[model samples]
Target: MDIKTATALHRLRLASIPEALSFPALLIFGTGFRLALDYDKLVMPLGIIHGVLFIIYVVLLLDVWNRAKWPFKRVALFFLLAVLPFGGLFGDRILKREEQAGVIAARARKEGTVNA
Candidate 1:
């Protein structure tokens, strides 16, 4: 609940939004390009971009999971959401709600601990 944890969570939450969206976008574009289109040139670049975003998402997810000390169920849910199309939106909503509620920061403040 300290600042470090809060910051890491925030970063992860932000990163996840784009990462989640990119996957679906890539899928849609890929399908469209493959069928009824001659724009095959776009596939590789988009695939690479989505791949990188996915890697970033996984790394951030791990870092946040470790810092937050979240339960296994929560970690699994996030991981599952990452692979689903449009799932990132749901994840973002949950994270935003939790962030606004100040769940972690409030707990840290109540404990009278430093921002570490």
Candidate 2:
């Protein structure tokens, strides 16, 4: 891949991590506010925040999907991870691994070296 595409992929991957995390954080806060505090006011704002984050996560997922050309299973897995509590942390680790692998592969290709 060219430098620009690689850079964009990197940015998308990085952007996804925070957005993914935000969803769950808001989820916990919303749950806490609703169940423990018995407050409805916090629900709307937290819901809005989660909604926005969900949209961002989906958009980033699409960008990553297009750029990475990941298989359907992997794509679905990432989508699944987006919804589960603390799943974003797992997703972030996977993305980090992918990024590292891509960097290594790119370096190898650029250096005209083949892995065995």
> After aligning candidate 2 to the native by TM-score, how far in Å is the CA of 32 from where it should be?
2.2
Clash pairs, candidate 2, are none
Clash total of candidate 2:
0
Which regions of candidate 2 are displaced past 4 Å? Answer: 1-5, 111-116
lDDT of each residue in 26-115, candidate 2, tens digit only: 767787878998987887888888888778777877877787777889889988887776687788787777777777778888888965
Q: List the residue pairs that clash in candidate 1.
A: none
Best by TM-score: 1
Candidate 1 lDDT over residue span 29-86, tens digit each: 8868877687787788888998898889889889978988989899889888888978
Candidate 2, 65: how far from true, in Å? 1.2
